[model samples]
Target: MSQLHALAAAAGVARTWQDADGRDQVVSDDALAAVLAALGYQADDDDAASASVAALSEEMSRPPAFLSVDIDAPLALPASLAAAEAAELTMEQGERRSLPIVRGVLPPIAEPGYHRLQIGEHALVLAVAPPRCLLPADLPGVARKRLWGTAIQIPSLHERPAPYGTFADLREAVRLFAARGADAVAISPVHALLSGGTSFYPYSPSSRLFLNAMLVDTSTADAGLSDQKEQELIDWPSGLASRQRELRRAFADLTPEQRQEIDAWSERQGSALHRQAVFDALSLHLDERDWRKWPADYAHPEAPGIAGFATEQTEEIAFHLFAQWLAERSLAAVQGEAKSGGMAIGLIADLAVGIDPAGSDAWALQGTMLTGLTIGAPPDPLGPDGQNWALTGFSPQDLRQSGFAPWIATLRAALRHAGGVRIDHAFGLARLWVVPEGRLASEGAYLSYPFADMLRIIALESHRAGAVVIGEDLGTRPPGFVEPVTDKGILGMRVLWFERNGNGFAPAEDFPAQAIAMTGTHDTATVAGWWTGRDIGWNRRLARGNWHNEETQRMADRSALWSAIGSGTPQPSADTPAPVVEAAIVQMGRTPSVLAIIPLEDLLGLEEQPNLPGTIDEHPNWRRRLSGPLADLLAEPATARRLAALIEARRA
Candidate 1:
């Protein structure tokens, strides 16, 4: 390997990668240099390459904050901790005991969870995880072999909340679904998003640790603001402002005791909460959306001035905290309702792959995040030019240095209010494709992550939460990755469109048991839209270059899919999709997967998808609302029959 290639390898970048079409693709020297530069490495010359490699190697060799050990597996420690005269072991529960380390290797741990090992000042968290994660069947009330649920973009849901479906509205819908024998309600990502942009898209959250407060139901007995009955789509920038105004009103009316409790809660959240509150206040005070453009003193979370500002502008800080509290309260209420309604798994939350580089999470967690690189995917058949999500993710190096605390916290937050979690872009666990700040997605290369350790953390958290885990491992995963994923008890996702057999889709009976079956995800077209070739129209209108030329083939794919589902409907054209919709859904429900999640759009026969991967503004992604209100929509004669057929399929 060349010096640059060595540096790339040292930094965990794949030198040569294969594209989606199975063609071998190599990262050019120029691309390698750019990616290296983005990772904060300088490889302009041979000397620079050697220095970068040495530095990266040194960092990689350093000890991590925690080591994951399977149950009954021995944990080896550095000599310093092992040689200490006095060492203590603190289990996940409050139990503590002395340790007798033999030759830097501790005895096998019998239980799973976080165990603190301390040898004087040399201490570390020993994450003892289960051999695998809990399965969906492990949850209560799931008497049937297969579990099924509806996926909802909760904010876009109507009536369930009275006005617009906020978190409150969603709870109502959940109750209705629970009554209909649904086990779970898999919702879109509720992670906090950038307030000023089209933040309606759930995938591009600002912080995985928090919920999007704007989507909280703000209706009152008295008219504060008129109902937004204009269109199904939302104007996110304006919507956030409107919601915040209502939150302000709620905050202004806070009683003395309420204010005290809020203060205590803020204190309990500690630095992370305070830092976020401070960031919000600074952003509002500066009237700037991007934190990067803020004054130098206000940009860094740990700067001395931030603490003082939080104290000076106490109301602004409190406002943000109150909003977070509202979000948490609303979410908790929904979960409580789900549990009370006798559902096995109440809510299944979606966790986004990364956060925005110019958002709160980035400012607060600057130490654990890479500075110059953005996560993206290489050019594949899905998008010929590739995909740059423009999202900032954890630096694998920083994750180790920080002992993976950020990841643990993120997982806990998502699982806190839900019975299960869906990790978007699940392949990111093993590796991620990273591009330089200014480069196209095609210019990126793959960087390996700490897969086993991260998965262990996930398993540990899921076990503790008593929640099932699902990975959206739809695309190309690392070779031999799925076995361990299944072994760890995490279910992988299987979409109706992708569960293929020799250039066609597999029969429903052939779907894997260790997976979550779904009609389509938020990114894909709804069943009606897909069967009717509406997706082809959207793709043709928005897709650039040769990507849209396959409309004829896509139409053929629809026909093949209908046949594979055994719908018995003649090759349906754009004129008729009702029969295919009924059969397609029934086929998905009959899959062997423990969990079957049908998107609300598919359930209602909506034509537009919540998101289209490549097109942002060109498509009304994440803004489409279900037809009519929740009650009216679900009460439709057609919808009732569809639900009946789906339940029959699952029970069959």
Candidate 2:
């Protein structure tokens, strides 16, 4: 079919250029001969020229946009004068490298001294000139020091009754973590989501710049709205409803002077106000659908109605901006408390790879975004079918040409109140699989980028912010991902489960010294779930076709392999408890990896993992709340002291 169409297209082009007879009634023989020859047809040929011509015409008529030129045009460089002039211009431009711009100020690190750094899978040896500090000098004076303090999830920490409301509860939670010897608390992404009965997933955020208004502690009254009692369990729907009602009542109760003050404050932060207006407009337009499915006008962000909507939603925009300000203030307070409580690294924030295609970042920077491609993963041993995240990412060419404004802006926001930033899917710096929209993930090809340039930008921004960077270099890492990251003083992620030797899992003592070691990530099963065979069982159930049987057999093989290790007697039914897993992880910390982060769930011996990969509704993903309150967790003296001792020993 394709060959027939190609012929038809060729015939059509030949026919178009054919000359007509002098009388203009019919084509000349010479012209017909020329057309036939151009279409690869011959007068004496046995082949059917008509069928070929018809096929070629059909192909040409289908779509002109699909046609492409195949040219290898060589550059015709000018001689002497022009060449010299071009060289001179190039030299002048090369000398004028653009200075790095600072968009926002970050609070400085407490101690700004040279510290030794180790990256998980990379090695570096620095030679310093006289009067300059050497790489060894930057190493911490003590061996096996931790990169940061303990971490807790904010949502889990404050999951209590309504009277102990959002912000008030968070305040108490922060204080609790500080007293518990935690220097940092890593929380879920708090980006804004679709309001009015939407999925409460913090990750699939509608806007990266705006704060999740749901996280706003309504107890902190704005414009005279008093806190109200409500049902427990952080009922998102009811909480948003109550908060909106209170906001309306507060607006009504505000005096003219108070209204004026609010208006003045909004006027002062014009950019933030404008962004909020745009976001509100988009929310109304999108209405639970991705922006690509919207009307053509709304699809292109710069279309006429976008700016007008921003102008109309002035007060609503101000409200959103106010919410962000409150969130910023609260986070800063938490950092201050952590610092006061003797935390070395106050907050370690996670940065998501990309935003929803219909998100604020994409809307505001449409030109910088890739319109037709979605970033995803290739098929691997763990995920045989491969995975598509359904999120839009910045094109490397566009990002580079735009001076990395979008990347810089996102980093600045995350690091503003964080002591360290963990870049999710950090391998994205090298290459990203760009699957065309509506295409399968397997069809995607790797698109390379200038990794060194990107890392330089990251290092520059991080250094300016005084924040350490931990690259999540898990999964199938690309060749040479470690070198530049380590050279730039960034840390690497080390997952104990995936750390293996040729025979089986590597011993904990063999783990790298410069990495941030962990038992598992949000995507993996918890210690209890892994022990009980729940994770493998879930995987088998989710497997497609005969894959289910294959996965089950694979699990059995893994069990047998574990038995061979002689670490413990294998149960016929997998049932390794949290204590065993915890002990293994503690032994991992005893390795060279300077930092270790134990999830609070593992420490508490929870039965379920925070998230189960490959299942959305089938598994309880991001919504799991801790069984006990923050105070109860702190009061668990034996558990707390034991974990603390491990951390201290690892640092030693």
Q: Best-fitting candidate, measured by lDDT? A: 1
Q: What would the per-residue lDDT of candidate 2 be over residues 1-652, giving only the tens digit for each residue?
A: 2333234335331112111121212223343333344324443232555556565456434311110111121112212111221111111113311212122211122222221211222211111111111111143242334543444555554444442235446557667766766555656676666554444666676666556666656443443222323222334455566666654555456678866776676677656446655665466555744555666666555777767766767666556555555566667776677667765666777777767776666766777776666677765655566577777777665665455667767777778777677887888888665555666665554555557656755665565566667788887666577776777667787776777777666766677665677767777766566666567677666663365565566476455445433357544445546455556446555666666776767667666776776677777566566655667765686457546656665666
User: What lDDT, from 0 to 1, does candidate 1 have?
Assistant: 0.81
Q: Candidate 1's residue-wise lDDT over 367-466, tens digit each?
A: 8997888898888777678888889899887898788999999999999999999998888998899988787888888888889899999988998899
Superposed Cα RMSD, model 1: 2.5
Give each model's whole-structure lDDT. 0.81, 0.56
* TM-score attained by model 2: 0.71
The superposed Cα distance between candidate 2 and the true structure at residue 405, in angstroms, equals 1.2
**What C-alpha RMSD separates each model from the true structure?**
2.5, 14.3
Worst 10 residues of 1 by lDDT: 218-227
Among all windows of ten consecutive residues in candidate 2, which has the lowest summed lDDT? Answer: 64-73
